[model samples]
Structure formats: structure tokens, C-alpha cells
Target: MDLTVTDLACARGGVTVLERVNFRLAAGAALILRGPNGIGKTTLLRTVAGLQPAVAGDVSMAPESVAYAAHADGLKATLTVAENLAFWAAIYGTDEVSRAMERMNLAALADRQAQNLSAGQKRRLGLARLLVTGRPLWVLDEPTVSLDVASVALFGTVVREHLASGGSALMATHIDLGLAEAEVLDLTPCRARSPASAGPGTDDDPFAGVTA
Candidate 1:
């Protein structure tokens, strides 16, 4: 398995956000995690990315094998775009940061402060960070938010290319990404106490009792 999550559980403030979620993904594949608001989509992605302290589960992954792009930029406002790219590249020991920036259409913004860029620009820069990394697994949360239609189309292209390049992706997106042939993994019923008991506005969670 390129990625696997067995008996995973997540919590936030004593609320069960996810429970008993399990899956396996392979290289050169893509999977979409779909749900409505507050259904633990973001939480689940964080868990997969190892950013969130999982409540209970064995999430086996390749070390330094994943790159995550969240809804927030996570950019240093005081730093210029090139500075940001250089900083991340140096941190990751990569020398081809400029090429990644150019691929993300942020080369022109290289001298601009991250704070000064528009939301779309910031998101692009954030994505650039992932591109420059050599990680094999990608965990994206609402990647196309605040982007124009053109940018959204561009994102679909990027994702398709990434899949074609033998990379794997797990994404949580409310909007249709228009990927040519990606599979959808609906976790709604799997995360709930039971399918029959699950209803609208009811999202099943396993760590509902844990704090944070």
C-alpha cells in the first residue's frame, strides 16, 4: 500500500470528528474525500498528513513522504515570494525552487511580499511549496478556494499531471475538480456510528470524547 489508514480516529475539543476510518491508496492514483461542512474532511486530511495528532490508528506512511497544502497560506507575510520559495527550498535542501515557482505562475510575484499578494496568489505560492518538495503523497484541503474559474481549471490540469507523473493525491474539495477519472471515497457512512443512525447534519466521529 502506498498509503494506509487503519482504524483511524480524530477528535477536536472532546468532539468525535472521525472514527474507524480505513483506506489504502497506491502510487499513480488519486482519491477524493467528500462531505458537507464540519464533517471532519479537513481533520481527516490533517491526520493523513501527520499534522494532526491522531487519536487512535496506525497510519503508515513513508517518512518525509508527504506534502500538505492547507486552506491557509502558512506564508511569512514579511517575506518576498522568492524569499519564501528559497526558504522552503533550503529547508527541504532543494535547488530547483525557481522552476517550481515558475510552474505555479508566481515568478512575477517573486519580489512581492506574501502579505501583499491576493488570495489566489497566496494559494498559488502555497502550492508552489508542495511542487518544489520531493514528497510522494499529497494531501490537499480545499485547494481551489478563493481562485477564479481559470485558476480552478489550471488546478485540475496540475492534479492530472501529478497523477500522470506517478504521484498520489488525497483531496477534500466541495467543488467539482473535474479530474478525468479519479475515484471518490465516500466516508460518510464509514465514519458514523451506523449507517441507519446517520442522517443529515449528523456526521459520525470516533474521537468525539477526546479533547483537542
Candidate 2:
């Protein structure tokens, strides 16, 4: 599936942080979001993933087509690695649990509980969830956090495979994942004017666009 965002606006803490954002991610492609810290990359991703509403504009895609992985690992600490993937597989109605584990290099750790894994292992497990999601679009935020160089390279390979199979990805990361074909969208040009800088007649509505 393809993702098309047009004239998008995103907010953080009830304030508009990005506006006029536009991008088109075709099937079998990837888009990398780049900007300084706290520049609304996460907010934009959340909006695209349907975790939060956009302040304005539209994201065109099929419903339930997106698989989002945020900063949080979103794991069940007591669940074994295999069990965690199984849980998500059930949610997405997919039967790719074992394949997911192998893709993330967690096959050997399948019986290990999430809490017992190292930070990088936990990250791998979290990313492995995307494989079982059976969704065409992946929206990831700092997906390589806590991952070593080898793990990062592994993830890059996984993403490439995803794209090869006609999947699309949108991610925000500082480290290069070596995806030379991926397009980059820098959010700096899309940054919204702060409320303090707004012209007269603009309302200072602190509650506007507040995301839960």
C-alpha cells in the first residue's frame, strides 16, 4: 500500500509544532524523517499511524494498514520472546510469529522472558512485532535505540526486505540505516510558528490539538 500525506499539521502538548507537511511513500519504498530533537517527527508519525489525530490535513491510506513502533518497547515483561510475538500475531490475525523471531534474530531467545533480555534484545523483539503485524505500512520512531552496529545492520536488511516485498516504511532516525533508496523528509521547513510568535487575532488556545 502507498501512504500520501498532504498539507499535514501535527501538534505536541496542545501546540502546533509542524505544518504544511507533505509526502508520498509509494509501495516498495521508504521515507526517512529528519529534524532536530523535539521537532514533531514523533507527532507526525503518531498522526500517520492513527495513534493520534492530525491538527489538520490528510493521510491517505487504507484503514488498519499501518504498524507503528514507538520509543517504548511495548512488551509484556513476563512473556517469553515467542509469546510476545504470538500475542501480536493474534492481534493482527497473522501466523508469522516464528518467521518474525527469525528475522529479528530472536529465534534462539524464543524461550527467554522479555525482562531477562538485554536492552538490545528487547529492541529486537519490539521490532520483530512489525513482521507479524501483516501491515503494509510501518511507522517507526527511533527504531534502532539500544541496538548495536550489527543489530542496526540487521534491521536495515529487514527493512530492505520489507520494501522488496512491496511494503512501505516511514521512520525517524539520526543513524544512517544504509537505505540508499529511501527518501528523506526534513521537518525543519515544516516547523510551525510558536504561539508566542503568532500575529494578533490568533487565539492562544492551549487545549487545542492536545494529544492524550
Candidate 3:
């Protein structure tokens, strides 16, 4: 699916954080959102994912066609790794847990309870749910939070495969995931500027209205 954002604005706690956010991502591509902490990268991803109403403008995509993975793992501690993925797959009306397990290298840990896994293992399991959702457009917020080097490589491979198969992704990350071709959007300029420096409604983010 082609995802488009038009004159987008976002807020957290009723305070606008970003404005004039615009971008378009076609199938088989990826876009990386970069910025310092608390600059509304997560807020922008949430808006695109439709978790909340956009403060202004439009995000054009069917909410059902988007799969979002937020900062937290969102795993059930008592459930086994496979069980967690299975639960999400069922919710997405899919049953392809086996391949997702293999992709995330969770085959051996399938029966292990989520609570028993280490942090990195838990992160992989959390990301495994993305594959199970089978959605065309993935909106991921810091998808690689606790992953090790090799595991991060694995994530890059998975994302590359997703793009190769005509899927698209929007991700916010502090560290490099080694996605070379993805367009980078620095959100620094998009942050709300101080009233003293700029008038009201100026995009506060430093990267506002810009893409690279």
C-alpha cells in the first residue's frame, strides 16, 4: 500500500508537537524517522497508525491495513513465545505462526514462556508479531529496542524482506538498523518552535516540512 501524510499535525497531552508533516511512502520501500527524545517521533507514528486522531490534516490509509508495534513489547508474560505470536496471528485472522517463528529464530524458544526469555529474546518475540499480522504497511516505533548486534541484523533482514515483497514500513529508531535505501526524515525541525523565535503554528520540530 502507498501511505501518504498531508499537512499533518500531531499533539501529546493537547499540546501540539509537530506540524506540516508531509511524506509519501510507496510499496517496497521504507522511511526512517530520526530525531532526539520527546520530539514526537512516537506521536507521529501513532498518528499515522491511527491510534489517535491527528490534530490536523490527513493520514490516508485504511487503519486495518496497518500493523503497529509500539515501544513496549506488548507480550503476555505468562504466555509462551509461540503462544504470544499465535494470539496476535489469530487476531489478524492469520495462522502462519511457524514461518514467523523461524524468521525471528524463535523456533527453539517457541514453548518458552515469555517471562523466561531474556530482554533481547523478548524483543525478537515482540517483533515476531509483526510478521504474523500480515499487514502491508508496518508502523514501528523503536522496533529494535533491546536487540543485540546479530539480532538487529536479523531485524534488518526481515524488514528488507518485507519491502522486497511489496510491503512498506515507517520506523522510528535511535540506532542504525542498516536500512541503506530508506528515506530519512529528521523530525527536529517539525517540533513546535518557541513563540519568541517564530509565530504560532510554526512547525516546532526542527525537521518540519523536510525529508531526505
Candidate 4:
């Protein structure tokens, strides 16, 4: 399951955040996106997820082949970790949800409600949803934000397994989780020129109303 982004461009509030981004990621590899704030790292992830409008390019990916984890955990406050994973598993048709939870070090908190868990715990659970999707391409935004060192290691292990099994990941993170042989697609170079204002189409734009 390889990912190809050709002439990919995204606009937020009539401003182009990224453009001419051509890259292809093969299965069993990872690409890390690095850049400072307001540079569209998260926006890139959203574009891959088909959440934002690709103003002038093509993001061609099978709907069911892409999985995305955002900065905001999608966990239900009243739901237990097991319940949340179970729900996603049913949707994705993955009975391996328990296995994913175990790999993420979430088995211990499986029965505990998400609201009672620490920030790091919730983040881990939120990330574990990726496994449930059974998708080959993973797009993550600030995945390591609230993770502890131990949990971070667990996450790395999960990612390694994903790659080993012919899965690919595109991650937006400021911290180093020691992903093996990851390629960096720095957005810094593309930022030398400011984004021009543009109209939004049917792509992923979280800041549709925010001015550039």
C-alpha cells in the first residue's frame, strides 16, 4: 500500500499552506514531517486523510486504506479504553484490537474510563485506534505529544511492527521517538515564499475561516 501525493496543495482561509508537494511512500517505510508552527504539518496530515481541500493538486488514496490520528484524542470520556477500542474494532473489522491495546501498553487500563486516565494514557489509547483501522497508510499529527518515555517506546514498537507488516506512516511530531530509518520531508524550505491566498475546494481545511 504505497501513498502518492502529486502536486498537492492545501489552502486555509484563502491562504495556500503547502504546494507542489510531490512524494511517494512505499509500504513498510516511514516519513517524518518536520517544521515549525504555522507551517502546515498537521495540515499535511489532514490532506492525506482527505479532511482538507487540496486547492490545486491531487491526493489520490483509497478511502479505506488511510488511517489518521489527530492531536485531539478521539476517545470518549465516558467510555473505557476497552470499549473505545472495541467500538473501533467493530468498525474496522479487526479482532486484533486487544493485541493493539497490549502493544500500546493499554491493557492495564483497558477497563478504566478515559476521563480518569492521565493525558499520556489517553494519548496512547487515541493512537491505538490506528491499529484498529487495518489501513496500510497511517497519518498522525503530533502523535507523541503527551506520551511518556515508556509509552513512547511502546509506540515505536507498534510503528516498527506496522512497517514490518508492509504498512507506511506519515507523522508530524516535534519529539524524536527513534523511528528506524525515517526520511524527513522538511516543510521549512517550502516556507521561504509565503502562501498566497486561494479558494478552498473539497479538501481538508480545519482553518477554513481563519485568515492567513
| Top candidate (TM-score) | 3
Q: What lDDT score goes with residue 124 in model 3?
A: 94
* lDDT by residue for model 4 (29-104), tens: 8998887899887777887898877777677766689988988989889999999999999999888778878888
Minimum summed lDDT over a 10-residue window in model 3 is located at: 203-212
lDDT of 2 by residue, 38-113 (tens): 9899999999999889999899998899999988999999999999999999999999999999999999999999
Better of 1 and 2 by TM-score: 2
Q: What TM-score, to 2 decimals, does candidate 1 have?
A: 0.86
lDDT of 3: 0.88
* Candidate maximizing lDDT: 2
Task: Predict model 2's lDDT versus the native.
Answer: 0.89
| Number of the candidate with higher lDDT, 1 or 3 | 3
Report the C-alpha displacement of residue 156, candidate 1, in angstroms: 1.9
Candidate 1 per-residue lDDT, tens place, 139-189, comes to 999898888887787777777778888888899887777775777877665
Give the per-residue lDDT digits (tens) of candidate 3, residues 28-102: 989999888999999999999888889888888765889899878999999999899999999999987999999
C-alpha lDDT of all candidate models, in order? 0.79, 0.89, 0.88, 0.80
After superposing candidate 2, which stretches have Cα over 4 Å from the reference?
195-212
